[model samples]
Target: MDAVHVHMTNTSNLPVEALENEYPLRMDEYAMIQDSGGAGRTRGGMGIAKQIRAVGPGIVFSARSDSHTVGVAAGVDGGRDGRRARLIRNFGTPQQEELFSKTANIALAAGESVRIETPGGGGYGAPSARPQPRVAQDVADGKISAEAARADYGLSA
Candidate 1:
């Protein structure tokens, strides 16, 4: 029988400073992906993107993640589905490339970087039921873009 590893504590992301201090890497970006959540009466939570570069040679990269090719969180009650996850190598450069969701043991030279974008949660209820004030607030708070509010929530500019 396959045994599942269970933990009572909730998982948490490490701070950029801690990660850099402990590992031979430099954090490029660690921020929330704006407007990645599904649009709905109760909008879904946003995702996170983390980019790191190898500061030293002989860095072996590996990861076991999901939501890459398919199997994303689906919405309910007419809500929109969440965005997909991604693992990229050398993102935003001439040699940027997509890596497998379950890759392991990839050698990284110094200055080469990797980016992991986590998927957002699915929304609840119909987007038409969402209030205009809440949509405006989302825009004001930088959670969603004004264009997204207009397009997804049917709000006028």
Candidate 2:
């Protein structure tokens, strides 16, 4: 698990040691990614990419939805869909990153941090629901499994 503190400005006048003591996780380094969100008719919310240097090994879990789940974008006459959330790790590696994993064993020294970049949600309705054949193709391509397609997306095998 990871925690981040976003301070709008440096007006607190607190020392770095004080801030670190207040937070649960130690901060080795931090940076913000600009303009990571996608555009849609209703305009999707902006995406944020963050890198965290873990002070210790811990578990991580995430769940997020936009128009499809709770109607964040307020579907077009009940046609809008929410954006999907993704989890990736070891980004920019030649082996590529894993989209979703139950657990990751991380060995971090005193000054090691991992990078995480989450994708923005897509538009709802027609664009959200693609052709069944394409969905099957995704299964065949290993992007998703047949059982996962049926279970997650309610698609027929």
Candidate 3:
């Protein structure tokens, strides 16, 4: 074994009081990305999807997360690859812009919103090895989609 320890900082709902009611940064409003985890017996930890609506003018945002593609967590035997991070600015606006995993001072004006999706962890084994009841629970909890439950865990006819 090597002398190394790693830690991942959860950027979800980052506490920023400056953007409080002034920017309507709803910290409690986070959802799990549906079907975002890798397929495997030991289901990968779900990722967090959050959207913040900026209300004040001249607001700046900064973030850094695991990258998609190369940085995606590698799955175990028979387990599919996990999803990677994503960031979207001005999601519904004509000025919408897609950003990289790490971004520096970005200006966000009034009425603009940003959506951030953190990466999911890698799976452990074959998806089919996962229980049907667990898949159903995931669906009901909105962590994974119904289609994923059926396709990944073979819970549907």
Q: Pick the candidate with the highest TM-score.
A: 1
Error of 1 at 154 (Å): 1.4
Model 1: per-residue Cα lDDT at residue 36: 75
Model 1: clashing residue pairs? none
lDDT of 3 at 20: 73
TM-score of 3: 0.78
lDDT of 1: 0.82
Q: Where is the poorest 10-residue window by lDDT in model 3? A: 1-10
How much is the lDDT of residue 84 in candidate 1? 79
Give the range of the ten consecutive residues with the poorest summed lDDT in model 2: 1-10
Query: Residue pairs in steric clash, candidate 3?
Result: none
lDDT of each: 0.82, 0.40, 0.71
Highest lDDT, which number? Answer: 1
What lDDT tens digits, residue by residue, belong to model 2 across residues 1-157? Answer: 0112231122233454665676434544333222222222222233334544445445343423232223232334323333333344444546444444233454444334445443333333442354566556655754445664564445587
Model 1 residue 23 CA deviation (Å) reads 1.5
**CA shift of 74, model 3, Å:** 1.6
Clashes counted in candidate 3 amount to: 0
> Between 1 and 2, whose lDDT is larger?
1
Clashes of each: 0, 8, 0
lDDT of 1 by residue, 38-58 (tens): 888898778778899999998
